[model samples]
Each structure stands twice: as structure tokens, then as C-alpha cells.
Target chain A: MLIWNRAKILYIKKINWHLCLIFAAISSQPILTSMTWKQVFSSSIGRKLTMGLTGIFLITFLIVHMGINACMWAAVYFKDDHGEMFNKAANFMGSMVVIRIIEFGLFFFIFLHIIQGYMLTVYNRSKRAVGYAVDYGSKGSKWYSRSMGLLGTLILLFLIIHWLHFWIPSRFTGVEEVEYNGVKMHNMFALMQTTFQQLWVVILYVLGCISLGYHLAHGFQSAFKTIGVHNKRYQTMLTGLGYAFAIVVPFVFAMMPITMYLGWVK
Target chain B: MEHYNMSLHLKVWRQNNSRDKGHFENYKVDGISSEMSFLEMFDVLNERLITEGKEPIAFDHDCREGICGMCSMYINGKPHGPWKSNTVCQLHMRAYKDGDTIVVEPWRANAFPVIKDLMVDRSAFDRIVQAGGYISVNTGNAVDGNSLPIEKDKADASFAAAMCIGCGACVAACKNSSAMLFLSAKVAHLALLPQGEPERKKRVVSMVAQMDKEGFGACTNTGACEATCPKDISLSNIARLNQEYLIASLTADK
Candidate 1:
């Protein structure tokens, strides 16, 4: 009887151990941990953050690009040596290792922005399984704001064309080198002039610039708002600046192709 | 006030239950006074339907003066009809023409499933609010409100945010069906005052987590929420919510 009692007590102890082990495993299953990096980035807000950050970076790149291209007009100021300033700037940008590294980063951001933009568009569409019977186009928000997906798609196509015209040739092959202030650089100015000479290409370029302007008109203030600039005064200022940027930047970009095509720089 | 009598054709959604597929059923409402509110016109329609021995349409409503935020309707492709910053309860019949065809639907979002014709199970919103939408102080006699000495601008801003009645019109108007405007209004209202500082970090994080978990779509800053808001809630509240979330996430001890 004593032996049987001892054996029964041992069996109960063994069952208790198993129960403890199961409880421990269940409690430690990562459900109790705070949000992970994957959770933060995969959330809807995270996707918007990615879009806004990449957009701001691309906006900055546009400013630098516009500055460099504006040097084409400087040919008029320094008529003795047409496009000297422009060539010099282009050569510096092309040769610098740091700039080249940043160019890669810019490419990465552009692709990221495009991919995330499409993902968001798809997600937004799926949220509305049924379309409204009565359409209120341009009544609730601006047409451009609601049409961001279409505008972005247009920008992507234009970007591919723009890269083929200049970026590919300059970076890879079939580019004549010019001496600018005792330094050799890809002759981007000559390339631009020749590229713009085609009427179809020039027209496409102008249309691309217009699309870009509308995209920026909405995206500029949007990026700021997304990043948490919520004060009324600051919001008003940002909106004003956004309008100016939307008009002036694209206007300048559109002019580059037109002036080159018309031989205004020469 | 001038009253104009009008006859209108109303096509309203009728759903028996959440699981049942819904469709629009047309009803003719005659001799509706221009002075009658939009919900009153619906009341007239319901009276006619009941008289004919048909089941009355079910919708959510309280405080018919527009403060309760229960009245939700998607009228003519716009939430709360074509009038800006107007709830259906406040929308007068005068806004419609003599022979207009008005289509009404419920707030459509995966997060807000339909419970009946025009009513949705918005307990998801209540869950989000329960997550961290309040201060954690012990309940007792109220503190002297004057002792806080909150800045006038801050007070006003908080008041503006507090004006949100939790009407899901922002969600209805958003193309993405995002609850950012509504969530931000709650977050901003608490985050602005000193009383909310104790749990500020935890509140924003938990509420946003709850929001995402509820399966709402992301905000794209389309401005439709602000445009359709009956209380004129600003889009800036969304920006403030984003800021709060970012700060909390970066500084969180976990």
C-alpha cells in the first residue's frame, strides 16, 4: 500500500511538470512583445510614411536637377563660350563618386515610391468593393488629388523616357566627351539640344513636365502634412510654398526643352 | 423662413441583416416641406411604409439636432448629401430640387459592416476608444477646472478637436476608407491638454495599433474627410496624430 501511494504521488508530480512546461511555452510565444520593425513598416501608416519620405527626397532631387539644367540658359550670359557653365556642372556631377552614390540612392527611392504608390492605389480600390452610382468628380476634392494614381503612372512612363534620352547615354555609352575648364565630362548640353530637336520628343517632355507640376502641387503640402506639420500658420505657409514650387519648378523644366528646341540657348 | 413643398424619389439601401446582400428600394415622398430636415423626410417615408404594412427601414440616430453623430447617410455620392459641413440631421429639404432623385446608402467600409439598412456595427470604433482614448485617473469628485490654466489657443484647439461627434462620414468620404480623421480627432483632443500628458505616449501607440487591427485603410490626405466633416475638423489633426505616433514609436522603451 505504501509503495502504491508513493507511485501515485510521483505520477501527479510528473503531470504538474508537463502542465508548467506548456504554460511557459504559450506565454513566451512573441504575442506579448511590443510591435516589431516589420509591424511598424507593414502597417498602412508605415506605407504612407515610406511614400512621404521618398517623395520629399525626390522633390529635393528635382531642385538639384533644375539648378543644373538652368545653367543651359547661362549660355546666353556667357555667349563667348556657350554651355561652358552647364558642361562644367554636368562634368562635376558625373565624375564625383559621392554624387554617383547618391544617384543610386535616388534610383532606389524612385522605384520604392512607384511601387508603394501602386500598392496604395490597389489597397484603396479594394476598400471600396462597390462603386457609388452617382459620381461626384472634383466636388469633394480636387481632380488632381483624387487622380494621383493616374498622374503617378504618367510620371513613371515619362521618367523612363527621360532616363533613356539622357541618363542612359551619359552613364553607359555613346557619349562624346567635352573639355570644360581643363576637365573632361559627358557633353550633356549637346545631348539635350539634339534630343529636344525632335518635335515629338519635345512635346512629350512638355507634357511630362505638366504632369509633374500637378503631382507636386498635391504632393508637396501632402508630404509636410504626413510628416506632422499641423499648425495652422505653418500649414498655410506650406500650402503657399507648395503652389509656388508646383508652378515655378515645372515651368522652368518645361522651358528647358522648348528653349533648346527653338535654339534660344545658342 | 420660406417653405417650399416638393415631391422626391428616394432610393434607400435595405438590408435584412449583416450577412444578407442588400439593394436599393425606391419610395416616393410627397408634400415634403422645405423646412423639414433630411431625417424628417425619412420619417415621413417610414410612416408611409408602415401604413402599407411593410417593415420600416432601420437606421442609427439620436439627438436629432446633429450633436449625437449617429445619423449617417451617403446621399447622392457624397456623405451627408451635397451640403458641405452638414450632417443629415441638419440638412434641410430645401437643398434638394422639386423633382430630384436622392440615393441614400450606409457608410461603406470593411471595418464598418452593415447591421441593417443604414445602420453599421460601429463597435470597432468603441473598441479603439477603449484601447486608450481616456485619462487613467481615479474617479472621484471633479478637480477645479480653473486650476489647470490651459493656454487659450490650446484650449480652443482642443475644443475644435473635441467637436468631433464620431460620425463615420470621414470614413465614408475617404476613397481609402481611412479612419485617420476620426482617430486623429480623438488623439489630438487628449494630446493637447495637460491632463492627457501622463499616458500620451501609450495612448497614441495603443489607439493607432487598435485602429490598424480594426482593418481600416490608410490615409492618403485626400482632404475629403475635412471637406465633409460636419464639425469642420481640420486635416491638421491627422498630421498631429502622425507626429504623436512617430514620437511615441521612437521613444518607446520597448
Candidate 2:
């Protein structure tokens, strides 16, 4: 194939010099294409490894995300605190140049995970084209583990709405600005208060959080397993830790919208 | 145990070859003894088909006692049927009662293509094994068993992994048709032993690479394969494979 392409390119060189260069560029590369480092990471197991690594990174990001959002409960500690602490923490996260740069990396990883997740789901589904005539649902495995793709898609949908509510306003168009202790920044607190007023939005966010919980239920230990944490002791610990994280993280996140919607938080 | 006979209706997958578009063909067998193995019931049906001047349903089977992994059947939406840790040849008709409708099919995977009715070509498994073939031993006479001491847990784990018959049931039962369980079983079988030390890294890397080359799907860790495995191959082996491959690939000179 390489020789044939070279011969054709040589023949074309006599007729159209630019065409010959284009043909050579396109055809020659594949003819000599050998296994390289890039191909290594794109293989079946490698693709999963990519998912696992990126998933753990995203998991870490959620900690920061929830911790900062957890700042909304500052009213519990201080007198007449109206999301001031949450707003300041949110501002600190937003205005820092270091975080601003890392924001790109964060979104990049998120996008990579979403795209690769869908790709993996599609590829895996194709592995068994013709399914069994008799349905044996969830007898062999948990439904959530099999439905990661569905749960992930739900999370992605929620993200778009959540981002539209918060990310775009704060980053692109700018949020309603306010001064805390005479230091002026965006009143992301006010934005959250107003965003949760709609009952449908609150319901949707809760559903999103539920989906995220399930996604993490399978994904937390799955990421560990893929990265090679298979020992019985560590596995047992991780399984417990994974379930707790899955439940607590999403439950807290969901509560943010629920509390605001019900006027439980000021 | 008092024995009884039953009538059964079977919806079996039929295909001429890899290129042939397959469909389900139904067959009925009456007076099937409760003690007869599942394949023997098939034999009864095939004998009737012969008398009727119809083509006999072809399948793969050897050593009807279930030691040989040759028997491959997706009986009623599961590899090797309802019984846990049992192959098709060992599955008794006693599990069924009168007028039961049984659906049977070949292992559904791109890697395991249909050769005929209820039979798939599992050469892909052989290739994956061959990819991890041959541990290096200083060619010599047998040494003392105690020469290389191994822990009991490790030996038991390795023995469990070595019990894999390469039946392709894991692939059949897996939603993704992944060969991870089988591949992991092989990896764990060798990596736990002293004989497999020299080529440990090489074996895992090459076998996994070959598994990908065979067009199998990625492991999603659903535990379906472990559940369906006739040898009861554990999912821990898969986790171990993930560990092995991850470390090996990272440190690989390539």
C-alpha cells in the first residue's frame, strides 16, 4: 500500500505539484502508521484508564465545589449572615487568577469525561449487537452499574442548567454585584437565592443530584478498581467510603436548592 | 430422588456461518427425562430432526461432566443456564417442569462469531492465551516443590484463577461482551506464581493488547462476568488485572 501510494504521488507530481503534496500528506502517514504512545492510550484498557484517572480528578473537584457551596450555611454560625460567606468563598474561587486558569483545565477534564464516557458506552453497547431474546434484568449485576451512561447523561443535563444558572452569569455576563465588609464582588449568593425560587428548577436540580449520587455509587470504587486498588482491606474501605461519598455529597448539594426554595435559608 | 418426564419448547438460534443472518427456530421435545443433561435433551431433539429429514442443530460440547469448556449455550438469557457455577452439559432437565419454554443462543460477542446453530468460534480466546503464552523456566529436570515457597492464599487464588476453562461464558454474559474476566484469570493465574515472574510485566501488557486487538469491549466492572462464570472466577482477578496492567504500562520501556 505504501509503495502504491508513493507511485501514485510520483505520477501526480508531474501533473499537479500541490495535489501531490496533499495526497502525500494524507496517504503516506497511515501507510507508515505504527504503534505509538498515542495509540497506547487509545486502546480498550487504556481508554478505561483515561476515564478512571479523569474521574478521580473530577471527584476531587467536587470536594472543592461542595466545600465552597457548604459555605452557604454560615448563617448557622454568625448573626444575620445572608450568604455573605458563601458569596465571598465563591468570589475567592472566581477572581483568583490561578483558579481562573485551572478553571479551563477543570472544564477540559469534565468535557473529556463526558465525551469519552459516551464513546465508551456506545462502543460497549455494540459489543453485543443482538441481545438475548429473554430479558434477565439486574439478576447478574446492579442496575446502576449498567446504567452509568444513563446516569451520566442525566448529570450532564443538570450541569448545563446549573452552569447556565451560575457559571455563565458569574464568568461571562457578570452576576449582580455587592460589597461584603466594603470589599466589592459579585453577589453569587443573591443569584443562588433567586435561582432556587422556581419549583421546577429545584425539582430538576434534585433529580440531577440523585443521578449524580448513583453515578458516583458505581464510579467511585470503579475508579479505584481501575487504578488498581484491589486488595481486600482497601477494597472494603473504599466501598464504604464510596457509598458514603455518593450519598453525602449529592444529598448536601441537593439540600442547597431545597433549603433555598423552602425559605429555610436566608 | 423420584424422576419424571417433561415436555419443552426450545427457541434456539440458528445460523449457517459468520456471514449468515441468523434467526430463532423453535423445537419441541416430549418425554424428556428429568435426569437427562441439557445437551442430552438437545440430542433427543436432534434425533427427531434427523427422522424428519431436517438439519440437526450443531453445538460445541465435550466431556459432558462440565470439566471441558467446550459447551457454550446462552440458556434462557444466561450462559450455562439458571444453576450457578454449572456448565450447560451439567445442567439437568430437572431444573425445568412440564411445558417450559427455553430460549437458547450462541455466545453473543463480536469476538465470538456464530459458526452454526448455538455454536460460536472462540478462537479469539486462544489468541489471547497465546499472546500470554509460555513462562520462562530454566529448561531442566523437576526441582523440589519447596524450592520456591508460595503463600497458601496466593496458591489458592492462583489455583482458582487457573480453573478458568476459557468457555467464553463471561463474554456471553457481559453486557459489553468484555473478555476482561478471562484475561484477568489468565494474568492472575501466572502472576501469582514464581514460574511466571520473569515475563510478568510482558505477559499482562501483551495479553491486554491482544485482547483489545481481538475487538473485545472495555471492563466496566459490573460483575456480570464473575456471576456467569462456570468456574466461579472472582471479580477480584479483574481488579488485579487492572492493577497489573496499569503498573506495567506505566513502567513499560515502550
Each model's lDDT comes to 0.85, 0.87
Chain B of model 2: TM-score?
A: 0.97
Clashing pairs in 1: none
Quality class of the docking in candidate 1, CAPRI style: acceptable
Candidate 2 error regions (>4 Å) = A1-36, B138-141
How high a TM-score does candidate 1 get?
Answer: 0.91
Runs of candidate 1 exceeding 4 Å displacement = A1-34
TM-score of 2: 0.91
- Model 1 chain A lowest lDDT segment of ten: A24-33
| Clash pairs (backbone) in predicted model 2 | none
Top candidate by lDDT: 2
Q: List, residue by residue over B1-254, the lDDT tens digit for candidate 1.
A: 67789999999999999899899999888999999999999899889889999989898888988898999988988888878888899999999879899999989988889999999877677667656677756556889999889999999999999999999888888888889999999999999999889878877877788888887888989898899999999999999998987777677677
Model 1 iRMS (Å) reads 6.1
10 residues in a row with least lDDT, candidate 1 chain B = B130-139
